[model samples]
Target: MGSAAPAFYGRRVPLFFNPLEAAAHRLSIAPPMFDYFNTLGLHALVAAARLRVFDALRERPSTADGLATTLTIDPRTAEVLLRVLAGLGYLRVKGGRYRLTRTSRTWFTTDSPTSLVAGLEFWERTACVIWPRLAEAVRDGSPVTPFYELLESDAALSRSFQAWTAALARRQAPATARIIPVPRDGGHVLDVGGSHGLFSVELLHRHPGLRATVLDLPQALEAAADHPRLTLRAGSFLDDDLGEGYDVALLFNIVHGLDDQEVAKLFARVAAALNPGGAIVIGDQFRDSLMPGRASRTLLDLLDLNYRVATGGRVRDFREVARMLRAAGFDRPRHRRPLRSVVTELAVAVVKSPSRP
Candidate 1:
């Protein structure tokens, strides 16, 4: 028999990653041959975030040399990075001094309620590790290991994800609260997988008679704020006791992370838990619902692929969601775009009751 070539994946792939060198290249994009698999353009921003470049600039406009002294970076190096950030539109440069652009102030500072800084950390520390093995997930039609399993083991990665989720929730919750059809008479809501509990808080503020329970895993609920009307129920929405007779069940950004069978089961469970005439509002990125060439069409498709790689899940169309809901005893569902967001929309269904009929 001819000698077999050395195997590719079953053994150690040589790692050229140097933490110091990676840190040294902090202000620049890693060369194409960079050790980790981060996407190209993002590395520049990641480097700046890591170096707290945005934070320093936010304090006051500063020349490269001044920032270098404050940040303990070499002046020459800081100049190059500052110029790059300005070019990237994250900062503005004039009079040899750099300062935060509106974009940076809104989304980069850690203190900003909608800050996306943790997004970079999640991508670098968690998502990149999953990307290299994405092919296996695709070919197998499931994630090699589900996303939460990985997070369960890595506290740092989990915290980064939680922070990102919370920031995103803060941006979207108010709009969602406005759009969601809370019962007019004021009843209970089941906020399924409501990790950050921002939605529940918003709903309670909007409707005085509304009481909400945010059901999610215990770890995800750690940062969830307590409210007299908002109960944090730590458990699985898939297998655990979801209390019955909820007036509204909000499944936001959830279904894309579950398989079809799991979605069907969960929908049935949701059906059983809702009161007569109660509505279910599912907020998610539906790939088929986006118009062709829409601004967020690509983002929706990317999320579909990302979900596939992370949880054996894929995006569903409004039709698919409606069919599942109908099978679970809901009336025909309506797809509504309530938020200014192009990607996330709601598919709402109501449990039929004799009074409503």
Candidate 2:
């Protein structure tokens, strides 16, 4: 993959401090005044994505009128959208035709392996629904219905969410697989709540002798890949059997959606499902302790709110994660950041003898 996808989201370090937010803080302005929305350019990008404008320009350049004819939209609106896209550097106009920039061609087109189209669609479907209801969540201390429940009821939303998450898993799989302590000779691997199965697939690719199982909801596994070395089990990781005698278990990006009680129970369940001497790798954006305030890790701070709004969950800090692991009968967990993307991290814990307490 190219380097753009990582940077497109954000950087690992803060480039500058925002004195405006500080001024707002001094004046006691509501946080929403600054935090409520993205810049208009981002909203434009999302609109273009949902409209499939990037896909239209993927194969060949087109004038605004030509694109409007192809997409069956008002020519004037199409012209404005194209101009906006071009102005934002995602598109370039030459000889009265518009085309994708190199970064756009690589990461935004549907044909690209690293396409972020699903991500944009997902943002439209999920974030748009979640953010507007954030005040209610903050007030009631929970979403009216959890985001997963909402997804379960709506097929289109569920598919969009899965597609986006799977795209993310594909990009992150390589970076994640490297740090996980999979046994050299290859033993059983369990991927708990591994909805899209890309992580397990990556591990299988790396360790030829490894066999893996992806456990997730039935709806989530519908598009999961079938392989000779892979098994797909459909069920809730919280309330179902996790199967025993696993050498390595992967818990990736699923914890932020869970409550503290649920996390404790799930970790204990996974610990029981693993064989003695097995390792479990937990991956997500843990709350950064050093820079936990609004000035730094801003996305993470937003994500902490996102979790609360979407799932009644909050980002757990490093020490809290280790405490959960230790309470589940594992030793102190070791932390690793394979990609250094600042969006996610890994914590590895080993099961001692007599695996389940």
The numbered model that scores best in TM-score is 1
List per-prediction Cα lDDT, in the order shown: 0.78, 0.78
Give one digit per residue, the lDDT tens place, for model 2 in 1-357: 111111123222122225664455555662433233244656878878777788999867899999888889889988998887776668888988999888677667888877877667557755556677888988999864578877777767777778878877777889888878888888999998787798899999999999999998887887787778999998888888888999998988888889999998888888888888899898887774434544346567777888888888788887899988998888868888877335668889998753442
lDDT of 2 at 314: 83
> What local lDDT does model 2 show for residue 131?
78
Model 2 RMSD to the real structure?
5.5
In terms of lDDT, the poorest run of 10 residues in model 2 is 1-10
* Per-model C-alpha RMSD: 9.6, 5.5
- TM-score for model 1? 0.85
